[model samples]
Target: MTFPLIKHVRAFVVRGGGADYHDQGSGHWIDDHIATPMSRYPEYRQSRQSFGINVLGTLVVEIEAADGTVGFAVTTGGEPAAYIVEKHLARFLEGASVTDYEKIWDQMYFSTQFYGRKGLVVNALSGVDLALWDLLGKLRKEPVYQLLGGKVREELQFYATSSRPDLSKKLGFIGGKMPLHHGPAEGEEGLKKNIAELAEMRERVGDDFWLMLDCWMSLDLNYATRLAHEAHKHGLKWIEEALSPDDYWGYRDLKKNAPKGMLVTTGEHEATRWGFRMLLEMDCCDIIQPDVGWCGGITELIKISALADARGVMVIPHGSSVYSYHFVITRHNSPFAEFLMMAPDADKVVPMFNPLLLDEPVPVNGRLKLDDKPGFGVQLNPACKLHRPYTH
Candidate 1:
């Protein structure tokens, strides 16, 4: 019995929502109410759908072993990521062994140094890295968590990130993270409205249940500090991504000024260990949320989590579905999971990237049960309409 060699790499841009119903989702990732440096026109806020292009579709990556074993993962890289994988990255990985993940990851990271390092390049690299982990796990006949040093806990509790916290409470989730619709541009009145909304939710879910705000990198240092301070009275567990990931100073200020017992979390958009070093070293946030599909995959997350562990900070990978779920189960630092309420109504618990992944286990009563399935315990949906948006 010989180990299989990595013989093939493939990437695809697949979407949902319109017809085949894949990449079709919406959020406040880029709101006109938020005056980012890129777009500050006061009139831009007049048209609500102006910056909706921020929501790119999904990019799927696959690595096939010489023995015909196939491992795959998905992320939000779209066609640009597909181009990188099929054109540049495949050449470096085609002849490597399944166990050559670290070296291969380095080659991918350094080879794309000119145009890569952050944003979609790291995202593509993350997809490839994740596929490699799944490949290695399949080769070893073990779950990814087992390969990552076995499970630290038997099951994972989940907090729902959705607009309807009241419905989430009914679903038996531990907590509900509401997305903040207003930003600093909305003015002090917006701040009061945001806090009032939290107060409303607090009144609804009562004192025991956890209620947090996912500001989605829109609030400023003062606004975030104030939100945390005011919302703390209502028992807001944490304030997440209140400012941009690059705003280390803002994070520092927010953390310093936050109410005692309140937690600050960021890093959903931060990449690699070096980027995370700034976050940990600055003592920016209490929890670091690295998306496994974007933060250098499981390969880099292990390193990032190690950094967080040493600094006594929790590493909660963003809602990357099974990609994060597998890694979360392996570490003690990642005490709980964040489940993005992907159901159209945000009431039911469906697979995070519904229709894109087969066998992706969503949480059952806010807890996910992992069997001894090989790899990340997920398979790509054959029904998914994959499009190669570029030739490489």
Candidate 2:
């Protein structure tokens, strides 16, 4: 049965409790925090904080039809994107057809043309697009992946990504990532220190389990090579975001120097299929890590996955496994979803859709299992009371 065209599109700006949520460390793209309580909460003190902290805002788009069928979506990121959705995109989207997502995306992109593409505008668009897709899936009574096409695999695998090796091992994750730290002394010493840390983590996690490191865009080719070489001795499987995104040639060089069987994955900050195309064409990375929320939502992610798959590249999405759960379940090529280990506070504030046990590693044997629930399979916690709503 064909669904009716959308009758109304309403956008709500929801503020949750937290401090300044935007000030993520330099070079990290897409701040996924709820911004609220700058005044009410003492944690909002920016003086004590170096990064943007707080639940900025959640842009929830609800699409309704004549038959009373409704769909909902929520965008991550902080206040800036939320403002765009509430003040800008919502009016333009009202009464628009839900099925015409491409048209809607194009119109929104053009409307914000003067502002340029990427960054906050695209981030906002990502959220709205996700919500629309969720609504569509609900309308059809199918999971978002099935609506996209069909499942690629019966289950999706996940990597236990964290900086803390002890916690990861205690949590029962076979594969874990070490958080990227700055070079110990800022130059060569720091680089040596980083290699040493990875070597230590390797000793901790043992040789059989998968071990990786996120450089967090803090290394040059020379330093990365040094670290990768040391990492290989301890059986480090992959190194993520080792070089800055602008260092394409450097990555090519690093890839050449990197030990065989060691994979390089990136694209958490990269936008759209075009950005990924450049990465693939350049042979910049072996694995692709696209955040479904930031890398143009599920709509664009599916396309990006296809692009990666064609090249035999693995697609492992970054952040909030809850949002990515359905997509991972459906997409065959996406091998795993990253579970952030340093996000206990964030998770406590915005809990997972289906919280994983500390004992059972996600993907018992390299296969992820998704809860059979509708609309991203997530429900907001009632305990975390909303502070205020943004109205245009």
Candidate 3:
């Protein structure tokens, strides 16, 4: 089981939607009036880009083995992350074994802890960690899923996240999660509108299909509680990321106060196992959604998922396309996956990270059958321009 030493590490930044899926152009459903912490401001409320959600662009990390095999990963961090990867993180992997991901990850995290326990620094570290795993898979000539212990199920089932769940239902997803367009700042009328939208969609999709709301950390405790109760009337399966990720106490209260049948979910913005320990140990939410690209890559996610699995909690990763697909298929706790509707109007299915990844998989009729391709079964899109902002 000899593995080649890592030879070169490179970091690149690319703009306009890849790993930075939020950097979409005008008229994309993702950028259209999605509720957020910045929604209180009248001007920025209309579009997320106005609040700089997509400002980071994308960070791509490539780890090349001495054998000339290159494994790469993409995450949202842009030039800042690229700088971290090239100037800081690359030292851990340049001459390390491709199989020493654990040691490399430990060094990368501890060396940067003075500045980054989470967020941008963790994102850069995560990109490198994922690239290491990709390199390991390539070196072993196995798909990442098999490297993770093989699939527990025959295929992956998914729910759609978009502005229109009705269209997703027609597309055959098991559930549809719509963005909550108006937050507490929008007031009572906005509250009514939010429930009305849910009710309307519930009617269109019938009572059986699972419908949920993604608040995107825009609601207060009182507002989230109220929304939960009202949305429960419409058979809302869950209310997601209703409060700020730091509000563990608030999440605990919201989880308790939410309607008996409705579930409280959060953690898309959370990072690392320690952060998730606060969520789980505090009884914060029913399900913890960690984005593979953001929540410390596969290495940290393995720890995070194990924590959740031990407590009988489900770990449904956020919309991370193949990075999530490879991990999700191997875990029993992750029964299904999330397919973010990348289509501008949510009218059709498209690759989640379009134009950034080649051979990226998408669900057909709400299900995905993963192939045995090495690494994550995809490659950086050759046509997409990658900017090498920094070099180690």
Candidate 4:
């Protein structure tokens, strides 16, 4: 079968909550007192935004086929990422076969290898790669899952991430993950407060509901180990991203010393198959969490998943809304998905990427059944203004 060649590639930047989920306004739960690496500074400890976590607004990448079909994706990168897409990555897509994503990805990765093995460069590549897959699904007139492979499960079951696991339980979710408020910098009193919060939530939700802590890469080995041992008493399912993504040895030690039956998971910030290889080979954690938008998109994720699956490790992607859903439904290792409670109070379920995507799906009773629509089954909201930051 013949395919239309890629016609053009474009990049745009938008502010506020779209893909840069961190660029939220005041009082949003996501930015409220979450522990981070910068928490050691007294001035930056209260809010993540205070430390410039949301400096990168959102970047939108669009790829148009010669046949006039357009596929696009959003991720955290802003104007810098837009520049990478327009000035560097677009060259590999224009005039190539729409289905030549493998070659295009290789070109994009290696061409920028001097400065682009991970972080912002990989983020830009990921946005472009996902747009290509969306384009392929549209061209084939099938849902992205169908193109990847038929569904392994009928529907996806989700655990909520928020400040209120108690509220999430009332909403019918299977489990809840809360951010660890105080880090190593806060001393013994902060440690007691952290455990107190867990114990209180455990009592409210009762036992058997999964309760986990997201440390957000803010702890050292000693602190994470102590926290995990303490949290285990309250039936903590896992302690996530406790150490820096680069600290493989710390993760290995923490995983080993962690209370029996508890999981140690990380990888939201790690990118590419090579980075994941280190984690699996070193037996870093029980599960691996890769954000689809940040971990080299679907193409690289496939390779990363295979690595984890071989080692008997679970693959649970970080909250990326539809981008993660389409891929999760197709993998056996991906047993359940994550739904981040973006509601300001974490009281009601809201679209994870609200106001940016039209027809975005949300869980009903903590479960979601995907539709047959093609290309991730979403459209960019016309109401949100988008600025083209660069032109190729």
Candidate 5:
């Protein structure tokens, strides 16, 4: 019997009705509508501009088998990511075997070696890899996790992620994350302001809840140490993206100073097992945040998680909560997945098959729940209004 081979791959750039996904007020970037009083440097002002105002791009891979089974995968990003999907990835995947996902991934990785590894190349590879996994699951009549190894956990516990105080209260989430703000100013004043905000967030969630703070690469070692100290006092669980990736020594130092029970987490921007291996070897972080969509898709994430597991560390897949939801439920060691209350109108922007739930396995008492649906269990909403098509 002949195995199924992928017939075609297509990419799309869909513009959704919202601000750039990253520009939302976790305090990293200012809303574009607000004009700065000072004549700031061009680079500084541009960084503050909002990119989430519209859907920059979404890449979907449709793989058709000889038997007519169809599988889909999607990855979203800003201009660089979108450009790779549109200009390069699909051509490489054309006529490839969906069954040999690893081989195909290797092919893409080597092909793009000249462009250097990771970043946009791996991100684009991530989309294709996910679509391939989705295709494989459909072909085998099993969920992607089962295909990877098997279920480690039947259900997953999730932390509610939001920047808005009222939304966090309404969601009844037991765990919440605050957006990363720039580290304290030159004086104690900035440090004082940060501590006050953390205290306020702690009060909002009460004593029983879990809380994390994202620094969004906004702090240096000195500032990170100070904030970590205060955050510990507030009972914060972890400090994420506290410093730039280059600050390995800073991370080691920050880790040493962090409160006893508190953990240091980062890696959303780091790529592949190589990036993570360094973080692990250096003892830089207690928890690793790998995006299944970004870190070479399911294939590399499984590898990265195993690396973390061997080191007695934890794996928490970043955004694309819908994808991570299914991925996490199947994994045994993944601690918690992030549920973004602040994500762009998830229900409206996510495909129909991937509808956001308001009930159990999601926002239950204080935790988000998982479903037993087949494959990833999410179907693209056939009713989704924006469906643009691109062919290679």
Candidate 6:
């Protein structure tokens, strides 16, 4: 099928559009503690807060073809990303053929190397690339996964990343991962407390359920190793982003020395294939977790996953709602997905990107199955007030 030309690229910033997966106001242990990453430090521990601003903001992108077919995606870097999308990135996609996304992605990546190798620029690039894929899928009357290849699994099993593992188990999720509250700065006493909570949760969930820790880039190699050593007896499945993302050497050490059978996963903050190559080549971690919205969108993720697939490493894109669902369903190595339980109290499950994207799918029985809809099977919520933060 000959698809129409890519006619326009546009982006908007919407406020009040995110989920508090951390359950900040729930008064739960970690939820009630640590407002910012800095709070983990001993000096700032007492100054912790309950919430921050981004919970209500996002950037949404849309790519329109000549025939008026539109594909869109929503991401966290909405305001800043809009600047990249309009001031620069739009030039590469507008007037290009819809099928020329790979070429467009390469051009966008290389052309912006001076100022956009990673971070917000790549995030903007990712939104645009995803919109292009959505456009191509719409033109072919197929979902993005079908366009990628085809489904590699019958259904996507999910593990919950929330405070309430018991609730997650009751909801039929395969496993539950909790955010670690303390780090090395808290000393040995803090490490003991971390283990104590994990042990309590393990007992609550029983022996068969999988338990994991999301350290959230808040530990040193020694702290992560010690935490892993203690968490091992609690049946921890893996430890995620325990150290700073730049610590490739630390990651290599943690993975090499982690408790036997414990998996190490990072890259939720890492972007692009080149960035991922650092992790893969150095043998940094056991699994690679890329958020397609941040890791150069769907385009860079495919390349990252291809590299990981070749190396026998897993490529589970972080819990990014529809953006990730399309990719995970098609890859063989991404056996399970991370579902961010957005329920404020961690008492109920809801759509991850509510008030921004319509027709968003939620998992059933710890498994997610995509519907047979064209493009991503989702649309911008008409009720979502979109404001263009920049003029192009």
C-alpha lDDT score of every prediction, in listed order = 0.83, 0.64, 0.93, 0.94, 0.65, 0.83
- Each candidate structure's TM-score, on Cα atoms with residue i matched to residue i, is 0.93, 0.81, 0.99, 0.99, 0.83, 0.94
lDDT of 5 by residue, 176-271 (tens): 777654344324765686678778877866776787887767677887887888788989899997777767778888888888999999888788
Query: Which of the numbered candidates is closest to the native, going by highest lDDT?
Result: 4
TM-score comparison, 1 vs 2, better candidate = 1
Please state every model's RMSD to the true fold in angstroms. 2.8, 6.4, 0.7, 0.6, 4.7, 2.3
Q: What tens-digit string does per-residue lDDT give for candidate 3 at 1-392?
A: 99989999999999988988888889999988888999999999999999799899999999998989999999999999999999999998888898887889899999999999999999999899898899888989999999899999989999999989999999999999999999988999999999999999999999999999999999999999999998988899999999999999999999989889888999999999999999999999999999999999999999999999999999999999999999999999999999999989999999998889999999999999999999998998889998998776
Model 1 CA lDDT for position 352 = 77
Candidate 6: tens digits of C-alpha lDDT, residues 1-392: 67889888888887764422232344434454432356555565532343343443577788889998898877767677888889888999888998887899999999899997887788788888888888888899999999888899878899988888888999999999887877676777878888999999998999999998998787888888988998999899999998888899999999999988999999998998988999999999999999998898787788999999999999988898988988998999999898887766666778887666778898888887898899888888888688987766
Predicted structure 6: lDDT: 0.83
Poorest stretch of ten by lDDT in candidate 6 = 19-28
Model 5 residue 120 CA deviation (Å) reads 1.6
- The superposed Cα distance between candidate 4 and the true structure at residue 292, in angstroms, equals 0.8
Candidate 4, run of 10 with poorest lDDT? 16-25
Candidate 5 Cα errors over 4 Å, as ranges? 17-20, 23-48, 51-55, 78-83, 164-172, 182-187, 343-363, 366-369, 382-390
User: Candidate 1: where is the Cα deviation over 4 Å?
Assistant: 17-22, 25-49, 53-55
Superposing every Cα of model 6 onto the true structure, what RMSD results? 2.3
- TM-score for candidate 1, please give it: 0.93
lDDT of 2 by residue, 1-392 (tens): 68777666555545542112232343232232111122124343222132343335455555666677766655555556766777777766667777888888877777886993665677778878887887777777777767766667776655666456545555555577776554422556656666787778777767787888876565668878888887788888898887667677887788888999888877777778888888888898998887776777777887898998899988888764555767776666776666654344221112222221111223443345665555565544444343324555
**lDDT score, residue 63, model 3?**
91
What TM-score number comes out for model 2?
0.81
